[model samples]
Target: MFIAAYVLTGCMHQPEPVVTPIQQLNTERYMGTWYEIVRMPTSFQRDMSHATASYRLNADGTFEVVNRGFNTRKGEWKTAVGKAKPIDGMPAGFSVSFQWPFSGGYYIAELGSNYEYAVIVSDSHDYFWLLAREPRLPRWLIDRTLARAHEWGFDIEQMIETKH
Candidate 1:
């Protein structure tokens, strides 16, 4: 009875998984183009394919974000320009605004050592994206990155791979 009770208590005391963002993000090194490898679906990006996000650092330490993608149904390319500002005390956190007076959280939760790939998540945890420097990533790498997202308590079952 004691052993069973102890097991139940342990099971109830499991710690919540924490999302750890990168500690030191070099904005200079990160300034470039990144192809969307996979993402959790959202209305804003509906029917988007060959999606890519390009970043350019401004002299005042802000970043210009240009998100481009092809609309499969419309047979045309779409683009949105936004501004990103670093969040104080959060090395990998930024507030991105595409429209006036409206912004959203953009956090670099996980990144490759050489900045080859990155896992992005928002404050709501509903938005997740996997990005890479190149359009195509190795199958093994995709699998591994998805596994890591799962470990971080994200629902990876609905992740959709982007076509590039």
Candidate 2:
């Protein structure tokens, strides 16, 4: 009994698996600018703030991805232009190329009913970003978004709030 109690108390809790991408995503409906609200610290976005992403569907069925942010240290805006190609059979999944010949997985984990907010996660399980159509989301919407993300097994505690 003591050993069982100890095990129960000391064991690490596993994070639940995330749900599959939404049944269908209207890529056209998702195109536009989105401000980053929270995200994981990563080399790509290090020391940046006021981050925003824009998407534009191309005639070739690919999409343009532009990431712009202000470097805190330099106090200047920096931009990275990338391209995204949809992964076959996955409505919300894309392979994004920041440079030629190299692409990484991008998944739309969650999207708001009106396309007002989105939770994006990398296939590597290493990157996450909470985005909104506006620079800041309403408190209630933020709470609702967080609750939904928590239910889907995202570690909310690991999120770093993005300063605008």
Candidate 3:
């Protein structure tokens, strides 16, 4: 009796395994007040103070994000509202598209266990934010958060410590 051995070959072309997307945020709990502790500088908020963000979930299944800051130079409050949506399968991450259909990646990389603080990031990693429930965070918390940010590949030096 003669026995033959067969070899099996697998295709080299295989679809990349998809990363499990971030968790979708519970808008209700996410709503309320958030103070800016630090963020990547942007023209829109070049000169601002008392910076705060307020969110309200609309019945239409969208969040009404109101960003407010006091312009020291202008001596007035600046406010803007932009629609936000999840980027494909990213749950905790979203794309805040101020101009319809034009979106920018906004990812929530870390959040405080108590929902008092959160770290937001952009796809480019150039944009980042340290947000808290109050204008100032506890020293220990700030230090801990900063350490985590550094570990997460953020340029801690670039983070602008906000007054408000």
CA lDDT for candidate 2: 0.70
Q: What is the lDDT of residue 135 in candidate 1?
A: 97
Candidate 2 residue runs with Cα over 4 Å from true position = 1-19, 147-153
Writing each residue's lDDT as its tens digit, candidate 2 over 52-131 gives 98999999989888888888888888888887777777788776777655556667878889999888765434566789
Please give each candidate's TM-score.
0.86, 0.82, 0.79
lDDT of 1 by residue, 53-145 (tens): 899999999998888888898999888888877877788877676765556667788899999998887655457789999998899999998
Q: Name model 3 segments beyond 4 Å from true.
A: 1-24
Against the unseen true structure, what C-alpha lDDT does each candidate score? 0.75, 0.70, 0.63
Candidates 1 and 3, the one with greater lDDT:
1
Q: Each model's RMSD to truth, in Å?
A: 11.7, 10.9, 15.0
User: Any residue pairs clashing in model 3, and if so which?
Assistant: 23-92
- Which one is best on TM-score? 1
**TM-score pick, better of 2 and 3:** 2
The lDDT, on a scale of 0 to 1, for candidate 3 is 0.63
Please write out the lDDT profile of model 3 over residues 73-139, one tens digit for every residue: 9999877777655455666655565555345555676777778887776655456677888789988
Worst 10 residues of 1 by lDDT: 1-10
